[model samples]
Target chain A: MDALTDAELTILGLLVEHPRHGYELEHVIEERGVRNWTALGFSSIYYVLDKLAKRGLIEAIGPRTSAKSRVPFAATEAGREQCAAATREALAEPSPVRARVLVAMANSAALPDDEVAAGLAERRAALRG
Target chain B: MDALTDAELTILGLLVEHPRHGYELEHVIEERGVRNWTALGFSSIYYVLDKLAKRGLIEAIGPRTSAKSRVPFAATEAGREQCAAATREALAEPSPVRARVLVAMANSAALPDDEVAAGLAERRAALRG
Candidate 1:
């Protein structure tokens, strides 16, 4: 099977946690701070679900033709397997840290030292907020 | 001006460090562990330089029609200003960590405990090496 995007894997992992309606998935995502780490947007939940369903990795537990958002979706057995394998691969081969700040710091000489200091202060303020 | 992508900003920053040919950029990238955080590929360096040049952010010091790989490129004044602004923005609004392992650990119930343990062990060995 093709590798799942981070968004796909995240949503699939949530469903594997428990079958949930689209709205519930959004709630879980927000509660778990998934958006901070993954690019799964509020509007993209249904889109990701559709993709998962189309790939036969997940299926709606309720009537298929019913209102999509109201229907609870669960991971298919295949999805469980795929999610497991993807999870393992993700654990085994970690991705590198891609923080933009690292690049910015590396190139700090592009800006004045005072300006760099101010920028970092701004970041600190934002983080505190 | 449009915000530079991480790859573009990285390359532009390196050039701002000192004007260098394409081969030198590759060497510096390797030395600096740039690939760990950026998606820049070997073949895309010229493409990025073209983009920067097209936007008047950087310029080839040698003849424009000369062999692309051999020609040294430097940031224009405008390029320096833009890079400074970009650097400030990057430092100010730091992006959150997007580690896939975080997601994988959150979803570990998708796999058996032993498998997860083994996967982490494999990662540990890889890190040690």
Candidate 2:
């Protein structure tokens, strides 16, 4: 169903990999620079964890000082299933043509046909590469 | 700033084509099948129009009985500039990798190496094609 918002699915999906505390999740997000493409916020980590916990998609384990100074969260069976489904949805879904492209397409007259074709060719090449 | 959310940008970008009333916007949305990739709704059109107009990003033209009962809206100069900026942001901004792929990437061990390789190869082939 892709019921999870991009942030929620991202957090839960991360937990599916391993049990992680809030700080660990935050650390991984920063280390990977996931925030550049997605709007995952540092402050929203616990909020998502708590939300998932309430829905029984995730469970919080007791404090693990070894990793970080916070309780760790793990995906339950249902959570793993949810993660798989959501992940499939994410990957299978089309990467959207953003509005700027839509505007360009709508008013393509302003651009010479060759330039537009060239731009599209470059985009295709990048996707292929 | 891409301050416009996907819906807001979609709507404003539509107005960039021509002045359109509420029903026309709804009609265009349905005709385009945009709901597949984006979470646009029939109910949100006027709300978006009103919001854009309130921000002076759009101005309402006089009522046009021919199109529909609702008043038509047009983008103002500020609105056009905003559209251009926002549209640029939307296009330049990366279309994100959804959580599902991230999860699969993170937990690559569960899937057989060959399966992963095949999947990646298939994806690459699709992109190349």
TM-scores of all predicted structures: 0.62, 0.52
Where does candidate 2 chain B have its weakest 10-residue lDDT segment? B91-100
In candidate 1, which residue ranges exceed 4 Å CA deviation?
A102-117, A125-129, B1-35, B38-89
Model 2 regions more than 4 Å off: A19-23, A35-56, A59-74, A88-129, B15-26, B33-80, B88-129
Chain B, candidate 1: TM-score: 0.75
Instruction: Give a tens-digit lDDT track for model 1, residues A1-129.
Output: 557877899999999888999989988888978878776667679988999999999999998676777899999999998999899998988687667888898889768899999999999999999
Cα-based RMSD of the predictions, in order?
6.2, 7.5
lDDT of 1 at B12: 93
Q: What i-RMS does each candidate reach, in Å?
A: 3.0, 7.1
Residue-level lDDT for A16 in candidate 1: 87
Judged by lDDT against the true structure, how good is candidate 1?
A: 0.86
| Complex DockQ, candidate 1 | 0.43
